[model samples]
Target: MLYSPFLVTLTLLTLLTASARAQQSGPVVATPQRPPVTEQDRTEAQKFVAEHHPELASLLSQLQKSRPAEFERALRELVPQTQAIQRSKERSPARYESQLAAWKIDSQIRVLMARWSRKQDPETETKVRELIAHRQQLRREQTQAEKQRLTEQLQKIDEQLQNLDQPETQRIQAEWEQLSRRATIAAKQATKQKTNTTGEKKTTAKKSSDQQPAAAQPSPGSR
Candidate 1:
């Protein structure tokens, strides 16, 4: 049957729309990836860690365990796992970003937990375990719930810092400023007060030593 040109054009357009919809229903679009961390970026991140959280300097300085390197490894390792979510996202792009955000959140939590892991105290160790357990819950959470919980955890940490003394306050603030910038901020914070104490002792010693000779001097009556 002969068809009008307008009818033929309309038919082609209709077929294209159906094909596009079918593709949408069968596979989620893979997201454009963020650039992976570079060696220079790693070095900068390392320097940032040193300036902001130097205690991790040694552990991270090994060149093998740096945050950039570790994060790069984690992103690579998470690839297969993200792929597993492909089937679930097949229905919509909305789900894809949601899944990605959840994955990112999970990764961030792990990074945070690792930083908190070097504590030598048993009580802190127990709290770390509890923090980890809640993180696992965060992973399983719905998007809205996870975000709310994330906010709550962050605020709780902030409140804990508020309750701490000035030295603790400074440490927590410094570390938070470099969440992804360092891997050892917490460890550095833990030693901050002690380090300040050492500084105080050195100043006190100098003052005492400076006075010692004068105090030991011969009096005016001494020949």
Candidate 2:
């Protein structure tokens, strides 16, 4: 993760907005979210592998038969390719940019809702209520200029929220989802490799164990 504040805010708001929509139906559907991997990322990653590491594409079957060293070497080579894909872009696709803006505004609505849910300080409650009401009024404005002004206001709010030491819970949750997904995938891959290796070792050990008894028995007549 590159800690570009602007990209962080943009990505956080994007996921937050999606989560809010899901929440409206009932409970929020909590899926592990990864950082926005655009089509460009996939394309470039495939291209890199095909161009630089064509053999890796077929490593799965080969790894089963090859030495563990070969598998480790392949994984080592993939790390830089993965990093290049991840660092390729700091922003989402252009088609998603407008959606991000809309989601940014929706996330503020969620912020207000979360504050209200806490029901803690009366002062904070009143302030949040006022912000919600103001946002609703902005939504009702008929003029294009008024809408643009509202968008600007929302953008400023997003920037301010991004700067806070403790980010809004929604943003934190969204980031966690991204990190969790990445971790989960890596963990699953490691577990799978371990299982396969363990299975292979067990099979080899069993064969050796079975052969030992037969060898010790010698010829039938010797027994």
Candidate 3:
């Protein structure tokens, strides 16, 4: 199985970084100001939206006319993902499809988050949680798939080492060791990040529940 190094590295870095905690936190209510979107960015975003997500294209069109700031923020968020998808398609078609599926889920989650931000209702919050859970499952699937591919690669490398001289064997062993170390670190980091995310989510949920007055709280079946 083929894998894009850039995409792999990007994913690993995201999982390994301290910022991953913030990235995985509760829905951001405020859209942070980004640098102005250039004409080139808008054009590329339009092209990408038209090709991959017609719904987003319609949303973008409406935003452009009614909310220019939102239009820029959406475009800024989209263009990088669009570029990443394009690169994935070029490097690995199977991986591209997987990434695209995740991206679609991400898009849905974003839409739900926006709705929740505007009005913190139970139905929208429930949908957002469902999508987040689905996205996490997809990430697990991707990680498992990558692990299988790496196992196959290691097996091939071992076979090759058996036929090679001592010098070549040493070089292959070094390469294999490096790959093993990286995989080990990535696995550890991912596990830690997931634990933190779950804890944060529980904390956030508790706070949200506590903030609501008991008199105004809906029944369990109401959701």
Candidate 4:
């Protein structure tokens, strides 16, 4: 059907968008769990989903007309997708476990992309963006331990330069430039997989805030 791809894309984007907007609260998931599917459960879910499916079909038009970011959180949680459904194969349990696994992976990738785009927290995002900007500044054989050693050296130089009567600013700057560029390269390859027309890199960041049970938030100033 002409609507199939649109539906799938809408549902996936909704699920991911909701996850990013949510502010995580307390100690929650050991691991996310799904309840076992009963026949009544399957019937109710299927009927409701089929009836409301057109809401999702209309999402893109709605998105274009509204502030998608603001509305995304409320919409994502309520939309049901095949990944969380309880369907019978010949009136038995799911016969498509592999499909389930693949669906999860696809959802995860999309969510990470949403997380990066929003720049929800600049401190964390700067780290992500810096990595993206500086990718390809290094070689493949480098190890984590090696990188740390270089970073430490630059840090010491940074500190010494701070205390200087006449700072060896040029020397310190050169050293930092070398290690930072390499780290930047490695970070980019590890993250970005696609690019938008705006030339911004796209990636997914998912959170199952609904499927994931929310931990109770602490009262303000009550640590």
Each model's lDDT comes to: 0.51, 0.51, 0.70, 0.47
> What lDDT tens digits, residue by residue, belong to model 3 across residues 53-136?
665565566656665655565566666667878899999999999998887777666545654654689998999799889989
Output the worst ten-in-a-row residue range by lDDT, candidate 1: 11-20
The best candidate in terms of lDDT: 3
- lDDT score for candidate 3 against the true structure: 0.70
lDDT string for model 2 (27-102, tens) is 6557564455455654554455455434333332244244444433333433343554344334434324333333
Q: Give the Cα-based TM-score of candidate 1 against the true structure.
A: 0.24
Q: Between candidates 2 and 4, which one is better according to lDDT?
A: 2
Clashes of each: 0, 0, 0, 12
- Cα displacement (angstroms), candidate 3, residue 94, comes to 1.0
lDDT of 1 by residue, 1-223 (tens): 3333333222222222232234235666675765665556556554544553343333333324334444344333333444544555786666665665554444333433443443356664666566567646655565575588789999999998776756877878877878845657677876998899999999999999987855577878996
Off by over 4 Å in 3: 1-41, 67-70, 165-223
Q: Model 2: how far is 5 from its true place, Å?
A: 61
The candidate maximizing TM-score is: 3
After superposing candidate 1 on the true structure, give the runs of residues whose Cα lies further than 4 Å from its correct spot: 1-76, 82-90, 120-223
Q: Please write out the lDDT profile of model 4 over residues 85-119, one tens digit for every residue.
A: 33523343433443333333434434334454444
TM-scores for candidates 1 onward, in order: 0.24, 0.22, 0.53, 0.21
